[model samples]
Target: MSFLGLAHCSLPPQAESLRQEVREFLAGALAGRGAAARAQSWDGFDPEFSRSIGARGWIGMTWPRRYGGAERSALERYVVIEEMLAAGAPVSAHWFGDRQTGPLLLRYGTEAQRVSILPAIARGELFFCIGMSEPDAGSDVAAIRSRARRVPGGWELSGAKVWTTNAHRAHSMLGLFRTAPEAAERHAGLSQFLVDMRSPGVSVRPITDMAGREHFNEVRLDQVFVPDSALVGTEGDGWAQVMAELAYERSGPERYLSGVQLLLELVRAAGPAAGERARVAVGRAVASMVTLRQMSLAIAGMLEAGANPAQEAAIVKDLGTAFEQSLPEVVHELLGVEPDRAADTDLGRVHAVLLELAPCFSLRGGTREVLRGIIARGLGLR
Candidate 1:
């Protein structure tokens, strides 16, 4: 009946109210806000939308008050995100920073670093991206060769980060680099730094995805100077820090929301109560979504309890990506409308974009192979 001894979860009473509030906010706030684009989420950057969310105290909804955060419950934050993704808002501008980097910084960053960075992030004034993946090291995060040499007041970094989402427009990036030469242990001798996007030695080149969206980029770091205060946590402890951060990144509503809009559209097309086959398909899809969302929420509870469920998070991400990527095919079966843009111009745009973007779902956060390997090792099967 159970796999990992993890208990089933139910949302608290507050969660339902928060979800309703977010729904109303999105209904009036995001309606008719922007229509030229079609679900350009994740990498769909929008500063105005981010600022509006920040003004409503939703950016860092669950962080400390000193950093301009509302300090609400994690469940509340999850509800807000659920509503945002449902409304197809362009939250990619402040998504990475708010979701992973800011929280990580609040936990591990030094006093000066937090004082300077956290408030701006909470206000949605400063956007950030992660510099993890390199040219050859896709899933092997430990194989990164970005070098950061010790200098007078800080470190001098030199290297590049590939597939960096929003790097071209970000205000800063938290890049993992080698402080010392590579050691026998891949996790050793590595460090992380806050690299300013406006620094003299930095360069950002946009990489358009197959969907024709200029949302990804290659960020080059050439002798970029970062002050010693920019370091988060201990120097050699970055490998551990990054692993902990991935626990936050990999376990979230975003993993499942990638194709949810398409699913809802399909359901709309199928009518109130479709035939037996269509009804079964829709029920199966919704059940899968509900199950996955429960797993993600459980991880959030664990995080609130100050526990790290890294293996569990990796599992959710891998399975969730597989689940999200299946909506298009199932929709095609239940509804005869294909992804052909010209087939139905009324809503073909949404279907076409979802199909164009489905392949990348398994690639982002972490590849499916890497996630499965992590799960295998956790179960002592590797």
Candidate 2:
């Protein structure tokens, strides 16, 4: 088996120009935002901020114009996302819709679904949450026990989903349910649906994190009925469709930029009088970030070329999340500062928040073990 290599990819001049526009917009929008708030990273939810982003035509930039996209290049979209993440903007409101759901719909949804959903998502009016993990199954998506039974008009779903981010606030959920009995193949008999959050018998319970935030949720569905039109792609093909979606989830700059607020704080705390060791540690962290960005950009290029770089995306997410998870510890060691959320200094507060949030960096998109397994299988080393 041949090993995969991430080719160097450069952003176009247009993409850089778009970057400047995003920067200018964020400068005014994110003014007065403290480091503690910024430390929330993409987990920060602000619907108004998201709507403003939509008005700027920054969301769903790569989809066709008919679906409220600008029909811009993927690289342009990448630039916008990079800037948003780097600025530590509150983007969770539209993050799932713009990052994966819109693209998933464009690929697998019916024309009606696209017409009804994509425009709202592009306008940042409709928010979505993913329902894949179960109480028992986390990163092992195939082991999910959520079930959907055939009904007169559509399907009746009855199951529970855990760690569903923003489910309480989302208008809809892209849920994966088992439609048939378990077969010899573990991934068979699954289907995807766009379930309305307001449907009868659907309940959401927020899961507070170590940081005392409530972005994560546990969703329960008791025979929640969904119309036939809500079915995404062919029945029983959810495994393949979900795999494609994971490529989008794992290939973005969010994987690496989660702890950036802490990094910025470290730089502020370590002034020009910083010692050589501090400089070296900061330099190493920056170098890792740059390399991961290059790899992520390569995945975007492959995506633009109509290729599924699932393995490449897995590699980037694995490495990128590792970098993010390590940053808080590195900063603590370098600055010799104890993490205290109530501290008066920006660095202390940022560091404290990141210490709480960093543990989830690898657990969210895909666990470290799961990502490494993907990379190993891709390299034929398994």
Candidate 3:
């Protein structure tokens, strides 16, 4: 409960060694890809690349061995992910499954669910998307209208989810649905279900972003039937479950590293002859990344120790996203290069795409205002 007590964190000796291995792997795997490709970062989807990483037993590095995991520590997994992001590896194909869904399944899913799904995720043969936000819900989890009604052997789910990343390509979704009528407690009556995207009556339609990319999707469920085995954890416990999952989603390197290529591009564009302002700006950006990394690492350490660091995760996400969103603007000002989407240079392509995508960094994980509220409530300030 002490917000002032920042947990001390340092990579273990094994983690230090593992970093070199990951870097070497990235070098060979990412050979011809330039900064523009790296700028896509975790959002870049390459199933073949994901399968290659999985072949190395890097996908489920921290899960239990029985579930096809490597049984490594979270710190080890942290090093792998940091290296992947830093090198701008195309990790999106298996990123969500590795980052949160697999962990959540291990924690709250049935044993049968774990045995069936975790191994595929580790093998990079299956992908998962979260089903939290609805057309009406956005960040307000309590406002979701997607509901499930009992139907003998299982339940019938009917409603839609928006902003579902990779839904078109995902094999399954950990969907949140209302199981009962709204009660006096708004967070009550919510439930989580393991939805098979390929099931009858389920549909996925891509939603193109301003950048003309189709990473997000609108998933519609019209009386989709799921067996009882699909229910996750106890009934009406999804609110708590979703909150825990957010900690995993929001505290990672992706929160801050979205615009890393832009910073690198800035340095490349403003060579040694650049003015003092450019140097100072680059230094300041680097410092911010360092600070956020420390905070995120602290949270990762806590998670490794079986501790709930939701509050700390919120703090990292809020500040990390602010840093990410502002980086492109800072780069534009300091480098003074007009971003051209059609430009032949790596920096130009990266700059143009980042300028369009930067605004989403804050909106994607959790809005700045929502995250700040979570942090305040955790610190007893609300």
Candidate 4:
């Protein structure tokens, strides 16, 4: 089989109807939400709005009905995400739980854990944050020093996690820690635990970004006790599990749609009488978006078929982040206008924020160098 096996994907006819439904809902729901709020894109956090989306049964659309899922196809869920990001809807409150964490729990969590957590996540009443990156270990999951020493009926976790998105607001975290000392082989002795964020000794401090947003956090686990039941999958299996979870992370529409609001505003700012240069730039960005969307949809299809296309996902994520990072610069160049915060307009405010936010786009998920290395390994070039 070819290494870059990107299969064809066509959404079912029902996806169009779902798209229209989401569009209508957004039209009414986001009428005056403003571009500054919309500029946050998928990172926007609104628990009330998330609960509203859950009430619509849009969360966990692909899981079993026994767990509060809609039992819908992954493609159906794909359409909802695409529409939401394109409309700049606030989905951050439930995005991580719905997009990846919930699926991870479904695949690995115990029956009791599922019964207690899955329904609330599906209802958008609960939120989760990833506990992957640490201060000393950004992309290198193997370099993490967080340890969970075995104790009676539980483990005492002690270490800190950095760049933990929404950790301050999350109810729980899927924390990757060392269950045993590092082996000669780098990937051994790793484990993942579902940690309750509100537990004693678990502290979350907000980390402000360049954009002045407090979404990311420093999560400190100072000898926090986690029951053995919170262990996800098997002990010493976290390395493999994290790789699988990242496949879900890297293959979503959110990877590419981060700058879509800026792109939309750019077009509106340009209007119909745009010069040839502006037209060409817009056309190029549109082409990239279409191609990336198709590739992402193909990955979604692979996931639906229970395939682990981690390499392909890395390729898609690398390309998607490139596009996302470049979009703001492209818009700025095309519009030939400075990011104006004082302007009484949505477009200006959006442009201002996106310029500040775009630099971090490639850093999230994984860095370009790390993603490229993953792709190279996938192709057996390393």
Best by TM-score: 2
| Predicted structure 2, TM vs. truth | 0.98
Candidate 1 overall lDDT versus native:
0.82
Clashes by residue pair, model 1? none
Pick out the ten consecutive residues of candidate 4 with the lowest summed lDDT: 334-343
The candidate, 3 or 4, that scores higher on lDDT is 3
Q: For residues 85-159, could you state the per-residue lDDT of candidate 4 as single tens digits?
A: 988899998999998788998988888888888889989999999999888998888999999999999999999
TM-score for all models, in order of appearance: 0.95, 0.98, 0.97, 0.97
**Candidate 4 clashes between residue pairs 3 or more apart in a chain or in different chains:** none
**Model 1: ten consecutive residues of lowest lDDT:** 33-42
Error of 4 at 7 (Å): 1.1
**Which candidate model has the greater lDDT, 1 or 2?**
2
Mark the regions of model 1 whose C-alpha exceeds 4 Å error after superposition. 1-5, 33-38, 335-338, 342-347
lDDT of each: 0.82, 0.90, 0.89, 0.88
lDDT tens per residue, model 2, 359-379: 888888888999999988987
Task: Locate the minimum summed-lDDT window of 10 residues in model 2.
Answer: 1-10
lDDT at residue 7 of model 3 (Cα atoms): 90
Q: Which digits, one per residue and each the tens of the lDDT, describe model 3 over residues 171-232?
A: 89999999999989999999999999999999999999998999999999999999999999
Of 1 and 2, the candidate ranking higher by TM-score: 2
